[model samples]
Target: MLRVIGKRLLLLVPTMIGLSILLFAWVRALPGGPAVALLGEKATPEAIERVNELYGFDRPWYEQYFIWAGRLLQGDFGTSIQTSRPVVDEFMRRFPATLELSFLALIIAVGIGVPLGYFAARRYGKVSDHASVILSLVGITIPVFFLAFILKFIFAVKLGWLPSDGRQSPRIDATHPTGFYVWDGIITGEFDAAWNAIVHLILPAVALATIPLAIIVRITRASVLEVQNADFVRTGKGKGVAPRTLRTRFIMRNALLPVVTTIGLQAGLLISGAVLTETVFAFPGIGSFLATAIFQRDFPVLQGFIIFIALAYALINLIVDVSYTLIDPRVRVQ
Candidate 1:
């Protein structure tokens, strides 16, 4: 297991480097540099040159990349051209909010998806299975931004039960310093703020969860269906094991490997999917921050955000790979 982990870590180096290069080149190739975006069309050439020089954008592309990469290696992600804040600081400030949102969305997806899949597989070809299939299909078909808007309209505007947008109510005190306002509120005994945050989170989380839930359900159903007919499952049935026991203990144990992998893949999508949802909801998070940076053409922020997301995806896959040994003992043997 240790050797496998070491191998995976070694592989991540090249993967991250490649991702960085691709993202860096792509951002630079975009129409406007950070200076142009910041200075606007009315700015003088001297002003543009000064701005470029200050940000090191006047340097050769390779030299600029080396300087940025060096700062990243030393735990500095450079300053955001738009905000004048350190990229890492801005990211850290907003990342926890996105993480919390994604975590809740994932929980919602799994909580709904796993059971629906299990039942669909058990009922195979029946009405329940058909309904599950239709639900999954609809979940996948709908766009997240549209769903987020519709939810906001129904729950926040029409029903007036939740806030229309944003992370928390302005009336609440933000004295607690943790990045996660909900948790900080809870720790500070601010029930109203915590409740407000949760209510606001519900629509955005549901929107983000839709795709992952659908994907997990479909994958889980297929895996479970395949496992349910295996020789071990047949033997368990023949031995008079309770149907539920046979399904849960024997079938699900094998079926879960694919489901686990699906979940890990979907975990990477959580933050990416949040970009539109967060923007629509005006939630303060890495996604919203990235969107702002994109509009401003803040190359460093854009590059850093892309690198952060790529690292996140790679890290999640690595974790999934390492977990295979626990999920299936056969993995350890190899």
Candidate 2:
């Protein structure tokens, strides 16, 4: 297990190196360039040259990459071209809200998706199975923006059951020490702030959960269906084991590997999908942060964010791999 973990951690070095190269080149390839973006098209030639030189766009790609990479190694993510704030500081500030929302969505997805999928597979060819199939399909097909708008209209505008956007009500004056409003509110014994945070969270969390929920359901259903027909499951059934015990010990135990893999990958998807969901809902998070960065051609922020995301994705997959040994004792890590 230690060896497996060591190998995975080592691999991240080369993976991040490759990703940084791609990300650097990709950002430079954007039209109008950062120079034109910072200064309008009407800006004089000398001004553009100065801006290019200031950011080292005047240097060779490899040179620029090494320079930026060196700084990154020292934990300097550089300043945002748009906000003029340190990339790390800005990311840390916004990350909690995004984490808060994405986490709730994942919890909701797993809570509802796993059981529905397991039951659907168990009652294959029944009405519930058919309904699960349709629901998963619709969940996959619906645009998050459209769903978000509709949810906001129904829940926030018409029903007034939930706030449409923001992490808390503007009328509420609460300082989120940790940037996660509800958590900070709870720790500080400010129940009203905590309640407001949850109310504001519901719509966005539901909208963001759509894709991952569908994906988890589909994967769980397929895995469970396959496991249910295995020889062990058949033996358990023939022996008249209690239904719950049999399913838990044989069916679910065998079915979880692929579902775990799917769930781990979905974490990355949730972060990526937040760009659209956050934009539609106007929730202040990395998605909107990146969006604003792109419009202003803030290459530093973009590079920092993508590298951070790639690192996160790699780490999540590593966690999933480690979990395999724990979930199934038969699986051994090198």
Candidate 3:
């Protein structure tokens, strides 16, 4: 296990470096530079040059990358060109909200997806299975931003059950800031604020989760069906073991490996999907931060965000690989 972990960690370095280079070049290649975007059309060329020099954009691409990468290694994400605030501080402020929403969505996805898949597999060829398939297809087919808007319209505007936008009610004093409005509200004993935060989060979380949940359900159903026909399941059944016991212990246990892999991969996908969902909902999160950075052509912010996302993807895959050993003893590491 240690050897496997070491190997995976080693592989992550080059992957991250390649991702950073690609993102750095791609952001630089975009139509406008941060200076023009920030200074606007009327700004003088000299002004733009000064801004470029200040931000180190005047340097050679390799030199700029080395400087940025060095700062990143020292845990300094640099300052945002648009806001003049430390990028890491901005990230720290917004990331928890995104993390909270993503975590909730994953919980909802796994809680609902796994059982539905199991039932669908057990009832294969029946109406229930067909219904589950249709639902999963629809979930995957809809666009997340569109879904978020529709949900907000129905649940917030039409029904008047939830707040339309923002993390918490405006009336609440945001004195206690943990970046996560829900937790901060609770800690501050602001129940109404906490409740509002949770309500506002639901639409975005659901929108982000829809595709992943559908993918998980489909994958789980397929995996479960494959395992159900295995010799061990048949043997357990032949021994007169209870149907539920055999399905849970023998079938579900073996089927979980693929499902776990899917779930882990879905975590990475959700971060990308959150960009659109967060924008639609006007939620303050890493997605919103990245969108603003893109619009401003802030190469540093863009590079940092993309590299962060790539690292997130690699880390989740590593976690999934480690989890494999726990799920199936036969999965020997190294």
Question: For this target, which candidate reaches the highest lDDT against the unseen true structure?
Answer: 2
Q: Can you write out model 2's per-residue Cα lDDT over 1-334, one digit (the tens) per residue?
A: 8888999999889989988888998998888777788898898999999998987889998899999999999999988878889999989988888888888899889889889999999999999999999999999999988999999999989998888878888899897788999898999999999999988888999999998899999999999999999888889899999999988988998899998998899887787669878887889999988988898899999999888878878988999999999889888733
Candidate 2 lDDT: 0.89
Point out the worst 10-residue segment of candidate 2 by lDDT: 325-334
RMSD to the native, candidate 2?
1.3
* Candidates 1 and 2 compared by TM-score, better number: 2
Clashing pairs in 2: none
lDDT of each: 0.88, 0.89, 0.86
- TM-score for candidate 1, please give it: 0.96
Candidate 2 positional error at 306, Å: 0.9
lDDT of 1: 0.88
Q: Which pairs clash in the backbone of model 1?
A: none
What's the C-alpha lDDT at position 60 in model 1? 96
Error of 1 at 136 (Å): 1.1
Clash counts for the predictions, in order: 0, 0, 0
